[model samples]
Target: MKMWFLGTGAGRPNKHRNVTAIALQLPEPETGWWLFDCGEATQHQLMYVPLKLSKLEKIFITHLHGDHLYGLPGLLSSRSFDGGVTPLAVYGPIGLKAYIDTVFSLTETALDYEIVIHELEEEKQGIIYEDGRLRVEAGPLVHRVPCFGYRVEESDTTGPLLADKARALGVRSGPLFGKLKAGEAVTLEDGTVITPESVTDGVLRGRIVTVLGDTSPCEMAVLLGKNADLIVHEATFAAGLEEKAHEFGHSTTIEAARTAQLAGAKQVALTHFSGRYSNDELSQLVAEATAVFPHAIAATDLSMVKIDRVHERRAGQDEISS
Candidate 1:
């Protein structure tokens, strides 16, 4: 899976960054992408990416904050003009349905496609969404408003069939091989039972990615990010501003890294940066985060990061780029 940062600034947009919006490009067989937070001007940011509104299947809002979801109405409206006919499902905290309804009602806007809004219960924590291919778990986060963090887990895939092993075991490359690959035991013409475990490689473990809303470092954050391949945490301030960050219900770069460490995550992407830091100064946040967790990166606007199933374990590596 790949993540495209549409906006990375906190609270408001600046010259360098927009607000907090991220587009997660789903893997194959799924042609669409899932949007994280839809901050102000998020649709404008989408103009620069390869993503399309028609292909947006699911949208997960971390909170009801303006910086997190102010762009929802415009984006949803624009989708109709952009030929987005597929039904879209939006998952968020309570009051979300009312917010969307109020906007659409006041604006007298009509959508060609259906918009399904799911309002999560207050402080509810568990699987919010699940399908045959992916499962999403939501956990309450410590924020000024009712906020949440999401853990997206891809389903484990079957490993490739060992053609050489099957051939050696008198298994022909026909329907018998297909049956064995499908985890069914097949009896060959020679009366040899071939089990999938004996001929195929082990299962390939799926990847887990955690995306958090604006929050102070909390135990729930750790729980949502536990053993995640990548955790996208909000680092709204640098290390020295921990007090200010927490006062605003936000996290410092150090706190984000600590949460990643406590959660045993493989990598951390620090985002939701404050506009006080200039473009060049954003590196300071990355430096502070890397001090506590080596695999930490400061996400920049329009940057893209690829999350691999296999952990690279490289320290101080900047894998994301604009």
Candidate 2:
């Protein structure tokens, strides 16, 4: 799995950044992708991405803010022209369905594919989506509007099949061996009960990624991001501007870092910066975050991060992101 940022700036578009949008792609267990927060010009930004629209399976909206959702209609309409015919799911807060329906009704937009809307209710906290491989959990967040934070968690995979050991144990390569490899107890013809414990490796922890919407520091953010491999939070203001940040229902660089620290996150990725920060100024803001949490990183548009890979944060400047 991998994540790519389409827009990292907050509120509105600027020469430096577009807005809030991130793409999570799962290539192996069948190539598919999910989008988080389709802000203005998000579809245009996808032109630079190598993924196909048909592979886009779901879109997760954090809140109904214009900066986070304005581009959703355009992106959906353009999906038709891009030859996307598969069913797509959109998950968000209660008002999301009404907003989409209103826009489509007003524009009389024709859709070639089915759009499934999952409206998350207030105070609802549990798994929103779960297949055998992956699970998504959404919880209410503190924002001006009814916002949400999302946690994408992968299931722990089973260890490698012990084919050689099975063969050496006088077990033939067939259905019985399959059962043994599945961590099941199998009694042989001689009534020998073979346990899979010794043959398989211990369970490896599944990767967890938490993404939060615009908000002041809150317990929900820490809960959603607890012990996560990555925590993606908005840092709309610098450290000294805490008062302004809270007034706007946002977070400063220090607050974002504190959230990550409190959650025990391996890495903190700061995005959705207010337009006031220049490229150099954003680096300074990253410094403020890193001072608190050494693993803090300031993300930018089109930057890609692989979930299972180890990455180093550069000291002097941001990593090469395009």
Candidate 3:
């Protein structure tokens, strides 16, 4: 899995950054990718990356702010125009469906594919989406508006089959081997039963990623990001702006890092930067975060973070590439 930061500005766009938009690209066999917070010019930013609108499976909106959602209507229209035939699922706070419907009605626009909107209730927290391979949970955060944060947990995979051990136990390399690999016990022609655990390694644990919307430092953020491999938190101000940040329902770099540290997150990607700071000044913001949490980095526009499948839990830092 990988996260692509398409835009990373606080309230508005600037020459240095756009607004807030991030894409979580799943690994192969799952052709679709998920989007989080479609800010203005989000589709335009897509032009620079290899992601496709037709392959966009879901969209998760953080809040109703213009900077976080103004690009959604155009992006949905463009997806249809680009031949998106599959259905799309959009998850967000209440009133999101009305917002999209109003926009489409005003513009007299129609879509080619089905769009399902899930309106999350304020302060309601629980699992929002789940499938065989992955599960997503939502929790409320302390924001000016009713906002939510999501925790994505990938399901653990079965371990590889020990072919040599199976063969030694008189289990032929055929359908029986497939069944053993799937954790099913199989009886051979010789009446010998071979169990899955007896001929396979242990299961491989999956990775967890937490993505938060705009919010002040809150316990909900820490709960959502608990023990996550990566937490994408907003850091709208530098270290000395804690009072101003909390007053506006936002977090400073130090506060963001503190949340990550409290949550025991392995790495934190700080985004949603205020335009007051230029690109060159981001290093200072990162410095502030690293002082609290060693594995923290300031995310910039068009940067990407690769999350490898967790083989074993260890203490280390992940890298973000631009």
Model 3, 1-322: lDDT tens digits are 8899999999999999999999999976687899999999999999988899999999999889999999999999999988898999999999999999999999999999999999999999999999978999999999999999999999876567879988888888889989987779998777888888788765656788999999999999999999998999999999999899989899999999999999999999999999999999999999999999999998889999988775432236332221
The best-first sequence of candidates by TM-score reads 3, 1, 2
Poorest stretch of ten by lDDT in candidate 2: 313-322
Backbone clash pairs for candidate 1 read none
Please, what are the lDDT tens digits per residue for candidate 1 over residues 1-322? 8999999999888998999999999987578999998999999999999999999999999999999999999999999999999999999999999999999999999999999998888798999888867999998999999999999998765456889988998988989888876778998777878888788766556789999999998999999999998999999888888899889899999999999999999999999988888989978779999999999998899999987764222245322211
Worst 10 residues of 3 by lDDT: 313-322
Question: Whose TM-score is higher: candidate 2's or candidate 3's?
Answer: 3
Model 2 whole-model lDDT (C-alpha atoms): 0.86
- TM-score (C-alpha, index-matched) for candidate 1: 0.92
| Candidate 1 residue-wise lDDT at 194 | 85
For residues 1-322, write the lDDT of model 2, one tens digit per residue.
6888999999999999999999988747569899999999999899898777778999999999999999999999998988999999999999999999999999999999999999998877889999977899998888888899999987764354667876777677788777866668677789877776544444434678998988899999999999998899999999989888888899999999999999999998899999998767878999999999999988888888777722222245332211
Against the reference, the lDDT scores of all candidates come to 0.90, 0.86, 0.91
In candidate 3, which residue ranges exceed 4 Å CA deviation?
Answer: 312-322
Model 3, residue 116: displacement in angstroms? 0.5
TM-scores, all models, native as reference: 0.92, 0.90, 0.94
Clashing pairs in 2: none
Please say which candidate is ahead in lDDT: 1 or 2. 1
